[model samples]
Target: MTESIEKIVAELPSLKNVTGAWAVTDERLARGDAVFLADLGIALARTYGSSRQVWQYRSVFDHLLRLLATTPGRDNAVQALRLVGSAEVAGRKLDRYVTSLLASGHEVADLTAVFTGQASEELRACLVHELVLRGVVVEETPGIARWVTSPHWSHHPLGRLPVRLSDVESRADFPNYGAHGSSHSMPYGPLESRAPMVIADARVPSVEETTTQAAAGAMAKAVANWAEESNGRIEARLFVFAEPLDAGSVPEALLTLGLECLRGAGKKTELSVTACAPAQVWRVLFAAASSGGAYNSGSYGAYGRLAAWQSMAALAGCPEGAAVSEVEARVRDGTWHVFDADTEWFEQVAWDIGVAALAPGRRDLAVLAATDTD
Candidate 1:
């Protein structure tokens, strides 16, 4: 028999490399399979936002992953994930279904068993109804499943039009650096149907000067003029190259342009910032997320383009030889962060326009003098 889970949990973190070995092992830790175990490990890595939390969860997560993988089949996996997602665990729970299976003598009913045409119609209909509510279409022949539309569509403020097939590519030129666009616009209006519109990228002298009240007001007027004459919908993207330290400035500049100028007063616009600096990737992500903007790195068409995910994987103490593609896949599959990939996660988590109002501010010497300086 394999070592007890307590001992394994205690020893797993000390192993220099566990991902590869874990992938091949069927060693069960709370009844999850190998695949489930690896995914849990990655999720634990991403669970903690701080470095200290990362270290604290390392061993517990490693041991938790030693459980078996997620249960197979679409309906079964969904039900299993939902159950565990609701259950509380110190580390990620791989497959709670298996735990139930071992505990209940196979009495628990599942959609997979009902599809054989042996189960009662009432039971099968109940499962089918649930899948329909989830917007999933299931085929009985091959047991295939597909989404009628992305469940994520309504979750994003921009609504559904920005789906993958409709993404547009355009370009902009700042004085010093060139920008390429990866944009998506809503299809509800003629203006958004413009496919792609070219806009000049900002070439500010420095980060501190990137955003200012005057500049924001000027851009707001321009966006207002565009919105007044047309059906209201806007989306745009631009890229910039800067040192990692200065990269945070790009999104900040873009935020002021989007938030202060056009986003309020019943308007919607999404402006994305793409950069090349690996070091500044996370900072850009947090700032963009904070301001309800979008950010990414590398080519939009290319794989392994997100520097934030790459950096997060490293920071989470992922396997030494892990590939960018592997990390990216984990990001996509929700292995790393609770929200999964920051690229898409940020889009959904963006701050709502008008939720926060800008408060009055004072730069005047009179106001400053009135304040206690002594």
Candidate 2:
């Protein structure tokens, strides 16, 4: 068996036929041959650059993850994890595997153990970020707390705050901020056909034309990853008014801003709005920023959390080294009034959604609308 595996590894570079390679490996993996799979995983990792295509095979990647989960030997598990990490599966596939490993009781330290050497710290921090975004209960050790709460990580939802296992469990209601379902489908309903009321002194500015560079930068970062992955149009618009809007007019302002941002995407006649708590708003922002708008799937990589925090800080105009409590206080005190809106449009497929924030005192509003058919 060892000789045959070695032969396959040696010939992998010259092999022209993907089917032949799959046939041999898939049959053995189906038979639960852990030894063969483990040996293959190690050899592949040692020569990962050349054997890259072999990892693209789903069966091989799945088998490697299974080995990582069940292998008793720490060395074997580490090797399996390294191989899995080296794979180039598109989108959030790699993240799903990491989530599964964490689910199987593997600690963040256990996974971080594989990434040693000079550049490994960033990799470890990224893994931790992804786990937190996916709603995994991470034990906040001193090292992890520092990594998450560092200035770099503060813009993300849980970054500035202390990470608690209980917080992870309690946040199960995070998705309730917006109307989402188990089917992962967009909530589409009839909208009242009403044109936006043009308030006399209100001004809706293009994202690029925002008066605050920090605000503009934050809005841009918020939708950056989502725009890339969905290959969709995402508009982040800012509305500035001369005076604080009355409670009665907040919804009207949001609807007017939403419609303008959503202009080329077709007509959305009605608007459904729901008020969200500070925590809920932060979670939605973190999820959208971290996971490219597929927050429910746990399919995003490490930088999502980093980008989330940076953007939030920019949006809130947090000073350097601001305390977590201070930032939280600002959010809670209505420096940013958050809400979820469902504009009855883009029913074609997944991830057509809208969210906005109103800074009443600043007389500023930010609206983000995203649509993707693919």
**Predicted model with the maximum lDDT:** 2
- lDDT string, candidate 2, 179-232, tens digits: 011222223212333353333444433322354554565665745655666555
Report clash pairs, candidate 1. 29-67, 32-67, 32-68, 32-69, 33-68, 33-69, 36-69
The Cα error of candidate 1 at residue 102, in Å, is 26
Give all TM-scores, in the order shown. Answer: 0.25, 0.62
Global lDDT scores for all candidate models: 0.28, 0.48
Question: Candidate 1 lDDT, tens digit per residue, 342-368?
Answer: 122122222211111111121100000
All models, RMSD in angstroms: 20.3, 7.5
Q: Residue 181 in candidate 2 has what lDDT? A: 15
Give the winner by TM-score.
Answer: 2
Whole-model lDDT, candidate 2? 0.48
